[model samples]
Target: SAKHSDLCERRNIYADEKSSLESELDKNLVQRKNELEMTLIDARIMESETLVENESFDLELIDKRIASFRQLLEEKDAKIDELVKQQTDQKELLDKLRAAEDKQMDIINVEAKTSRKIAIKLETIEKKHNECLRKLSKMGTIPSDCDNNYHNMSLKDEYLELQKCKHKLSKMPSVNQKALDQLTEGREKGRILQLEKREIKAGYESIQRLIETLEHQKYEKIQVTYKSVSKFFVEIFQRLVPEGKAFIDMVYKDSADSGSAGSQASGSHASQESQSSGGISGAGLTPTFAQIDNFIGVRIRVAFTGKTVVKEMNQLSGGQKSIVALAFIFAIQRCDPPPFYLFDEVDQALDPFYRKALADLIKEMSRSSQFISTTFRPELLGSAQKFFGVKFAKRVMILENICVKLISDCNMN
Candidate 1:
């Protein structure tokens, strides 16, 4: 029984050891399960964070695209505004063109009416001139006959008066003293009648010369009047264009091809002189229609040295034409001087040296006339006695900067 009890105790000890080993195994298993569960929860949290990150990145991209689209819309709106402005400008230009066309048409109609009126007036003048010529011819013929008849009658009357004086002397001879007195009276009467006849002859000759002189003077006056008008045009044309030649042609009635034919005839005599001296004195004379028989026509020629040959006024460059036109206007002003002159952009085409020369010329001219010019160049400003600059938001300001610089320089000196 003691051996059985010892065996039982050993058995109990082994069973207890086994039970503790099982409990430790179960605890390790529980711990491992709890660790797996915690790892799974951590993995889920990481997946959720990654998803949130992707969503935020997508939202940022969408915001950028919207901003780009808004910029494109603004650009398109700006282009539309520019196009609208161009369309409005084109409409205004079209309106102006239509108005100009209408004005040109009105000018054409007025010119046509004026031409018709001039034609009618010319016809009337021609008719009146012909009637006057007819009347003059008739008067000339009648006056010549009347003068001859008057001369014959004066001679007959003188002869009758001499015979009457002789008869009176014979009757007075009965009284010797009376006869002598009568003879002396008759001699004195004869001398007086001779003197009267001589005076009458002289009066007739003087009257004829006076008529001839009056007709010659009338012809000369007409020629001079026409010449004066032509000279005026020539002077005007000369002033209008620098280094240009101009002339006027006078008209006459007697010849059909008078201008060319007469010029050729005069040229034959004029060829002895140089062409630079111009044509013969009378070579320019030409006959035209009755109305404009005394009228004068003008011709002008301009020579440009450099660049392409410009045959017409329109062919010249803007600056060149302006200069030429200004020269002409200045020449006109010289004919009738003005109180002063104002010039703007007048030296646009001139170079520095030429500009200086022009300023000097202006200064020289200013002795007789006052001149004012506006310019942006420093060289041009130097020409002025007093310089004023137009400043933004400020009234005409005298250029004090230059003066300040000059004073500083003087102080340094």
Candidate 2:
């Protein structure tokens, strides 16, 4: 009951204080409203002052955060400095490493060379050891009695025997290691050469046969042409010269060597040829064209009735030689007739009778061949189917007046 009274007394005291505080707060609120009327932003100024205080506190916090960030930046800068130093150290180390590698390579090369020399020396020693073992093996086991006998020999005698054996061994010839291989290679080369020789021989034989065949054909052509020319020459010469003997002789080196013997034979044959037709030394040329290369020439042998021996072309008169020339030309034409014959003043050296004979021959051949002759002789004019005359009216010689046959037909087409 006392504690309850104490609580009520305390509540009455708190109520009185609250009432006084409420009245005081109302009075303050009215004063603040009046102050706001007097200075419209006074409360805002007060709130701004508090806000400025809170902002100052926030600035302190930002300053602390800035200080922390600066420490962090300084730490990162130090780390960058440390990393740059490490990179510099690594670069220097890499240079040292490369230098060391080059030095090591030089050392390794030297060692490799030394090892190779040692290996070669070792191989030589091993070969010598193997050779000694092989020789000892070949010697086999010595008999006990022989061993005893060797043991009894003096040291000087054994040394002398060793020297003698060494001298004999030095005299032994060295074996050729490649003899079998060389022999095989030589045999193979020999076989290949033999095959090449056979092929060459076969090619040579084939070429030789081909040359022979060509030579035979060339000989046939020469003989056929010579036979026809010679036959016509005899008959034509008889017509041109009533009592003259003429023959075309192939002057081979062999016939020239026979001299007068060949001349006498050819002379007798020409005499008989006037009756019939045959010329001595009329055989075909040598089958080999190479022999034709050895040939001298064709000689014209003519014998007038007054002359006993056949005369060469050089012995005839100008007119007689001209006649023989005409005969020769006619003979060749009869044998292998050409499409045209061009005679430039051939009748100029001929006698009137010979010229007349030549004109007749031309007229006869005119049926098959065209003859263009330049001659002052009327005999050639008589045989002409067409004629062109030169007029010297101007300084230049102009061809004018086409005359077919006679001069009377100068305007003839």
Candidate 3:
């Protein structure tokens, strides 16, 4: 029994051990199985992700292809639109071309009608030319039949016949005597007109002669008047230059009626003292109107020292001439007093003594007429009734009648 119990206990322990081993083995197998299942699940998940990535990639490729197709479609649509615009333009051009072709056809038709009319006109012109050529040919055949001498004789005979008929008509009596009388009166009127024309020509010649005579008379009068004025000038000139004599000379431009050309007239006068010395003398007689003509164009000659010259009166020295002119003017004024007299710078050339004399003369002349003079010399101040001082400041002071007054000034005070 003890052996049997030991055997049972060993069997029990073995069984228990077997059972525990089996359990451990089973748990390990279950864990390995679960791990294998998880590995399979991960592989499935990786495969599903790869499939999804491939689907997304395919979708992206399809989208790219769709975009490319859309672009191509847009290009095609643009090409179609361009083609449609070109077709519309081509239609419009074709319509204009048709209209132009129709207009050209109308022009061509009109040109054809014009060409036909021109052809008809050419035919008519050719017919007329042919007729003219035939007429010219006929004329050419009939030209040289009559001799020149015979033709001239025939013309002379006709002229003689006409003259004989005219003679007969002139010799025949008029049907009405009144008509003959009228013809005679007409001839008398023509004769009178001819006489009047001759009279008019004679009158024109007479008028021309009269004009020439009048011009000659005017020249003579001028010469005579100039001689008188020259005589007065000579007296003044001689007084100016005590050493020489002066005379005025007349010059003529053309021939006088007496047929003398380039003639000159001169009248000379000298002082009494100069004449007594025989250095200068007058011709001893006054010239008549006829003798004055001989001296009408004489030139004045002035001799100073040994030199003889012809010079204008204005060429004389101012002071010398002024004295002479003043003397002459005083003489004239003494003879006939003027209503008023003005002396401008008359004392400019006078010496003190002459100035005094001139002042006295002016005062004497003032009794008959008004005398005004301007002087800068202090000696002349005593002779003035009033004194006026002109200042550089544009002021004028009048000391006239010893009542000093300001004539003009900028400042009132």
Prediction-by-prediction clash tally: 1, 0, 10
Each candidate structure's TM-score, on Cα atoms with residue i matched to residue i, is 0.29, 0.51, 0.33
Best by lDDT: 2
lDDT: which is higher, 1 or 2? 2
Tell me the spans in candidate 1 whose CA falls farther than 4 Å from its real position. 1-300, 306-310, 351-354, 378-382, 394-413
**Candidate 1 residue lDDT tens string, 331-372:** 456656798889886778765654565566566567887777
Q: Local distance difference test, per candidate?
A: 0.60, 0.77, 0.62
Candidate 1, residue 358: Cα displacement in angstroms equals 3.0
Q: In model 1, how large is the Cα lDDT of residue 100?
A: 99
> 2 or 3: which has the higher lDDT?
2
lDDT of 2 by residue, 1-413 (tens): 99999999999999999999889878998788788786867777888999999999999999999999999999999999999999999999999999999999999999999999999999999999999888765544434586776788999998797688668756864845346657778999999999999999999999999988987787778767776777788777767666777777666787678776666665565555533445433432233566665567677787656356677888888888988998989998887789998888887777887888778878987899888888876767767777888778758888875645456443232
Cα miss at 336, model 2 (Å)? 3.1
Give one digit per residue, the lDDT tens place, for model 3 in 1-413: 99999999999999999999899879998889899999999999999999999999999999999999999999999999999999999999999999999999999999999999999999999999999888655433322544553465777786696588557757865545245546778999999999999999999999999987886787677655554555554554444444555543343333244332222232323323223432222343333455544554543444433244433345656654566567556544544458988777788987776666566656655677887766766445555555555435447554433322432221123
Off by over 4 Å in 3: 1-246, 253-315, 324-338, 353-369, 378-413
Task: Provide the lowest-lDDT 10-residue window in model 1.
Answer: 272-281
Q: Total backbone clashes of model 3?
A: 10
How are the candidates ranked when ordered by lDDT, highest leading? 2, 3, 1
